[model samples]
Target: MIAVRRSETTLFTSREATHDNDTVALTHRAGLVRQFGSGLYGFTPTGERVRRRLIDAVDAELRAIGGQRISLPQLNYSGIWERSGRWESFEGEMFTFENRDGKRLCLAPSHEEGVVHLVDGAVRSYEDLPALYYQVGRKHRDDHARNGLLRLKEFTMKDAYSLHADADSLDETYERVRAAYVRLFEALDLAFVVAAAENSVMGGSASEEFVAPVETGTLDLRHCTAEDCRFGVTDESPGWASVGGICPDCGGNLVAGEGIEIGHAFKLGTRYADAMDLTVDGPDGDEWRVHMGSYGIGIERLLHTILAQQSDDAGCRWPDGIAPFGASIVPLAYEGAIRETADRLYRELGAGETLLFDDPGQTIGERFAESDLLGIPRKVVLGNQFRETGAVELECRDGTTRYVDPDEVAAVVSGTRSGD
Candidate 1:
């Protein structure tokens, strides 16, 4: 589909990369986990915690929009692929094959077909004109492959499609989705650009990519260094935006940067509506083609992106709301009764305070070394002397150490640490 949005005035505009103060991913054992990709990552309880927190934020944003996550099957058949003609165009980008029955199937590359198949069965009127359907599930791609989890063959993604009655209706949904995306990224604490983008394959006019730039992210975007620009961030994806003396949405000055497109929203208009003959009868009994748009965000990619942007050198530093387990309990002892103290402390830590007990069989050096690798924010050293003093030597991954009493452990975890 032809891009309908008017092009910006600038030529050869350079995209700026993200300026995060910190970006790190915590991996347990790499180049050693046989059969896994080089960057193939399996989240530690801590890493998983970080991923879930980001996911919860996304889902909460979706739920606020009355959207929900649904699962789509991994194997989708030839009928839809042939129907969309994606069977031919998808090429190496798509993972496709056939079973004994000779049905062309894919790893359900995208749910556009699946969703369309669903819509094809139910809605018959413009009263059903505006339907927004979304899913958070695994998607398959014949990826170019990469380091870490940036680009993977199989990963989670969120695809939302909106069906509307007219251009104005589609535009409204587009704007709402766009706003939600902005809020969503901001909530994740990453800088992103909403650049005017080309709908490479999804087939649409006027698309915007919500790119979040990280030092080593797979997606690249150009944006402004000055974060105050009201035009939001210009996407260097297809790179279009006119910068006059003033901002389009505000009077603020304009600036730029590079962005990693974590999300994209497209105004399909009647492209799919016409392709699939999705005409609906209006409440006034008028028949009209449903105007449509599709929004997509790679969920697992987002998880990796969050881990990329949010962590420190130690490990995945997940935000409090999303850490898989809140605390990592490391029992660093070189003396008597250390084991018993750790056991006692573990039993009495408090309600819902998840901890990983590192009862040392290794040297002090090994225990400390592992602590850096297993980066739970707050590390509680269950030492022998703790029971006497009524506290443990608390080590923070953010670089602070102290004697935290049982009473103050909650305080520290509750973020009361002056050192945190």
Candidate 2:
């Protein structure tokens, strides 16, 4: 069981860091993250728990689709980028520097060139054609990072690359990955739209992005408002018709909104493979350049988008699978019978999944506020009601309250997985 104490963690209030963005303000006040610099932030313990759950969810989806998880180097030599003819193209956005030996190096903003270089000679035949490699790690960029985690100089990303013998094979994997991304976001309960996106720097034949609509989002998107229509397009896409334009598929009304891009899928179509000489011999002994696809999901950006859409004036309201703790045991007073009962329930409900509010200094109202601020899904209150009737007050995040026998607490909370 991971135990957390209020006094042991750094939590801010609304009075600190006066910002116009409510999501940013609530993030700090909830102790989810701490900003180190303009574009850099570190996750607190509470935040790390939620992040791990999100990452695990992503991993499960990708792995189920035959994505082989691998770790790639964060720092890349200029030779790889130059060979791919992207060193100069990515000049301003990539973090480039000259090492002590006068050789230029860069913190990779994306791993297309480096990943291609890593598998250049190893994959020598069509049998090694459909290779899907993915990694979760830090990616660096030189953007004007602002709006909390929406834009950051350094951030965590889940990037996957697929190599295929031909465009048809690449298309097969692209659709699979696209489906997996939809399932992932759906499982997280995020309201998002998958839109045709522009292949700008990544340079691909086609691309699509999973965008979550939020007021603080930077991407402009047009989506059909019809219940049956799922048509959407980014403003930068070639197929983008202006807002109030007719929906190409369903002839529905298209509305414009701001959205954050959480995931992107690209049909690279031999762009990197040809530029970097990633080739394989065919069954007929002919040399063929491998086609490629790149997919990415910004981890922190997804987390922030959830907060942007789900948080209320009280605090954050985490989705089912990503809450930091499944249930919190908040006793009105931690003494005598209340303390013993709360401790017993914590153990019965699985200590790791349940948070016991053991701090005695605060009143019951203060404890309830703290529990709501943390966005715990369920609150098990051992109060005067428990003392009189042996029934614990069960409060859910949706503002519903009920009283259940002490023994039924575990079964009720166990209906969902904890922090998974």
Candidate 3:
């Protein structure tokens, strides 16, 4: 069992409030991340644990959809962007500089041009079409990063691109990817909506965004009033006001709200392939421009959105699969039988799956408060109850408490206790 002492990491649970948003406040208070500069932050140990789990979950979903994982370089030659006719358009937002060798290099904000160039000569036949490649890496931008993790100059992103021989093939892969995204968000239990969005710099035939509505969000969204209808549109779309405040699919009234965008999918068509001269020979020996689609999930933005939507005034309350630790073992006093029981329970529950609060310097109240702030799902207490009656108390994040025998604590916390 991975036992973590309260004194190991500097927690800001008792620190003074420094931010206006409670979500951002709790993020710092719980020791999730630390800022180094404007728009730049580093993840703490607990933060890295949660971040790694998020990446693993995203990777699993993409791999299940036949996406081959590959790494793309973050630094790219400016010539590719020039060939794609986007260098001037993206100059204001992209990070470009001249290397010592007198060559212009850029920290890519997106990989449309780079990916096409990477596979330029590799895809020479129609059979090689419909290739789906993806990567989870760092992306750079020059925006005024603020609002905690909502906006950052540099962030992690999971981006996938698909090359197809025809529009029909592209459409099929796009829908599959859309479904995969739905599954992922639902698994996280996020109240998100898919909305038709503007292509903007990506310049695609069509695109959609996964947005989670929150009071602190900045993206304006118009969603259907009907509970069963999921149609919505973002104000970024041109002529959005012409919709007459109605859902085109169900004629339901539309309501406006602010939201944070977590993911986006674009049907790029032949924009990048045509610009970069990536083509595949058809079965009839004719050269045809490859169709392309790209999908992106903002890793840090999604994490921040989760905190914004799920956290409360007390602290964060992570979802089932996303919590950094499954359970925390809080012994009222780390001595004698109490410590022995806590250690035994930690062993039974799997050390890696549980965190033993073994620090003896703090009072019991402090330990309990820290556990709650960390959003641990279950808190097993070995206090007077255990000493008097041999009954252990299991405290859930929702404020529910129950007593169970020592042997049953694991099953009860895991929801595998047979009797109920």
- Deviation from truth (RMSD, Å), model 1: 10.5
Better of 1 and 2 by lDDT: 2
Model 1 lDDT at residue 219:
46
Give the Å shift of residue 332 in candidate 2.
0.5
Tell how far residue 202 is off in model 2, in angstroms.
Answer: 0.6
- Name the regions of candidate 1 deviating beyond 4 angstroms: 1-50, 230-236, 240-259, 334-341, 348-353, 363-365, 383-388, 393-395, 400-404, 411-420
Q: In candidate 1, residue 420 scores what lDDT?
A: 51
On TM-score, who's better, 1 or 2?
2
Write down the RMSD of candidate 2 (Cα, Å).
2.1
- In order of appearance, the predictions have TM-scores of 0.79, 0.95, 0.95
lDDT of 1 by residue, 37-139 (tens): 6434455434444555666677777778766556667788877777766677777888888788887678876777677777784788777767777877778
- Candidate 3: segments with Cα more than 4 A from true spot: 1-3, 12-14, 415-420
